[model samples]
Target: MAEQIELHEQAPRLKSVSSPQDQDKGTSQQDDVDDTGITEASLTLEEQTDLDARRGQGFEAYPDGGVAAWLQVLYCFCIMFTTLGGVYSWGIFQDALHAEQLAPSSTLAFIGSTQATLEGLCAIPISALVARFGNKNVAVVGAILSGLGPILASWCTKSVAGLFVTEGFMFGAGQALCFFCAATLPSSYFSRRRNFATGLVYAGSGVGGAALSLAANGLIKSIGLPWTFRILGILFLAINLPCAYLLKPRPIISPIHHGAQGGLTWGPVVKISLLKDIRFVLVLIGSAVALFPLFVPPFFLPLFATSIGLSSGAASSLLAGFNLASATGRIGWGVMADRWFGSLNSLLLCLAANATSTLVIWPIAGRVGPLAVFAVINGFCAGGFFSLIPGVVSSLFSDDDLPVAFSMIVSLWAPGDFLGAPIAGYLLQAFGGPDSGYEAYRPAIFYAGGLGVFSALMVFGARVKEGGSWRRRL
Candidate 1:
């Protein structure tokens, strides 16, 4: 009842809900218990209304898996293709800036970091906007920013500072809004196949990254930098504009639990009290610490490959391999989590794989075979890590609280991303050598693996604390 009042205070709408009067109808439902000793609450009038409506209307089930849901997935894919894809593909630009413009590695790193910070900065706020004004409005504004940021960047090719503002900050902010929509909108369409849908949507990033890697490598080599930026900007606009119109949140997403309300207030205020949740705090810390290293590969892998004397063609190939594997991993791990392992366990296994690949495999990857293997494995595991984040968030909270929890999760990613690249750059500059780049990359590798392992441990601890056993759901 208190939660319902809170919801009423937040979003005033005609969303279907059981009236408080239903509780006084003298229904007794405390007798049901599940396998875990958790009592099952009886269905409320609102839920029965929903169930009957769907059944009689022959409307889609909780997970429709039909045209509407698929369209939502496609919309999310388009958003991620431009937004998260851009983030993943930044290494190509960083490499170009290093060689053609001769920017310092640290400076380039910081610029990328700034963009990452700006991108995550609005994730929490945007969730509320999506709830209030609808998803399409936020997407349109984001599409414009995403399209223009790179176009504006093309003219500033010679100036690193100028490019920083245009490419890093502008593009990052645009990506942030798109990312916000992508993360939230799909849930409105899917309930059962949500993890799979999210995996498919996130796979769009890997697809975009792989395609952009191939395109950037060829376009920059053939036509030069400015045109490449222009083309990319055009592509972002072309693809995202359609998605902006098409993507929408469904009414079905707003479900009331018992008499509790659905939908958050479409206001500026967001609940930050999860900071007090020990499990939530652990998840936050795990997210931040883990984020730092996960971004390292996207920012530096191509450069690392080239520094070790791999040709640009070979480096692009390796990066493409990484991206393809990442896409595969995104889908694979998501399937595993939904079907076999569950979210938290899948995340632990994913982190373990990433740590192993980074700590054990990467150090030995000076040659093409080893490096390619390392790249693919690392990318796959990293994809798993990214894919599981939403599931983890959803698992820790109720459905209505999902937006709040995820907002906090994505927003908190800023700090880790802002610092991750620069830290890696400095470590590399201090230790990398002319003869072999392995020595320099070692510190960053250790840093990534250590943080990943530490984050995994934190998550595991949270799991234990929440469930009191590894066997418990969480």
Candidate 2:
């Protein structure tokens, strides 16, 4: 039964029906506040549309399983196929650098790290930039830059520094641009299936790494490195170009407020104070902390395998188990979130499983059978760590506030992504048996497990904070 309260006068403010955790903080303000903390205004005869006019189009109703919607998912996969293909395939390029002889191993390693770091760091600006310029505009420039970066890198085969700028900085920036374009749009298209859609989108990276690795291996052999890069450069644009054309933001209405025109300003995009939202703040801390160690396995697994007495070939082959399992985990976890677990719970499950695998299985994975098993377990559980992100973040905000919530939450991953593996590496070097390749990685393994421990605990805290108790599912 629904009842209406009769007001003597029209209220100028909008009431927020926000999460349980926020009610206390929300009450502190005398004025009604939107989820993002902006106060509502009295309707003006000068020219004002009401709340209905302010809703973004797609979230009100998802297209669900339309051909057009599914096509966008496919397009996201293509973007991942190319962008993360490059990200994951950095090892191939790192190996090929020996032929160029322009830089030492330490110097060459920077090239890949720089590309990755830039990709992560630039995401904050790119997410907000999408509000100003449409997804297609940003994505097209990304496609152009992605293709041009490597094409230009091909010309500078003799100069490591030139490759650094072209392949590292330019390529990474382009990936960031194209990446957020695909990543941010999917949430608006499917509410019930948002996790499933996002899962497929992120699973693109794993799929890309597998596909591109084989292609890169063969391409480098048949055509040679420079030509291979040129071919890949061409391929990058070919894939992203169509995808960018199709990517679009849901129609939005930014309501007009006092003393200004009705348009998004640089102000909202640049605001970090939004971190003041407790829900947003906890999510940021939890995500960054989880990712700080969550990223270790992909970077160190093969190397760790070799240290355990496995042949280099066998160690490399083991990576397939992790990658395939990751793709499966992503889709599976997304389904779980849509069905039963919900975002925070599903994420907690993943982090717990990942941490357990790292501590118990990975430490003893030196044996061939144990190594394969650990790889499978880690990949399956840890894969959802990224896939579940859209769910958790989406739960924190209403449709109106989704853009800022998404941008701010995801921005945390940049620093975590860049720093995780390096921190793990330092631990290995410091604690591993002296001169024993990966034998002394015990301390590093513990470090990874420790990160997982804290990550899981922190998210549990956030989930409880959101829902107010264990009796509720978040």
lDDT of 2 by residue, 33-133 (tens): 53344554444543235433432221145666788778888888789778866877777777677656777755777777777667557756776677667
Candidate 1 worst ten-residue window by lDDT? 1-10
Q: What TM-score quantifies how close candidate 1 is to the native fold?
A: 0.84
**Model 2 TM-score (2 dp):** 0.85
Error of 2 at 373 (Å): 1.6
lDDT of 1 at 431: 82
Query: In model 1, which runs have C-alpha deviations exceeding 4 angstroms?
Result: 1-61, 252-269, 432-437, 468-474
Q: Pick the candidate with the highest TM-score.
A: 2
Pairs that clash in candidate 2: 432-440, 433-440
The alpha-carbon root-mean-square deviation between model 1 and the true structure, to one decimal in Å, is 6.6
Give lDDT for model 2. 0.72
Per-model tally of clashing residue pairs: 0, 2
**CA lDDT, every prediction?**
0.73, 0.72
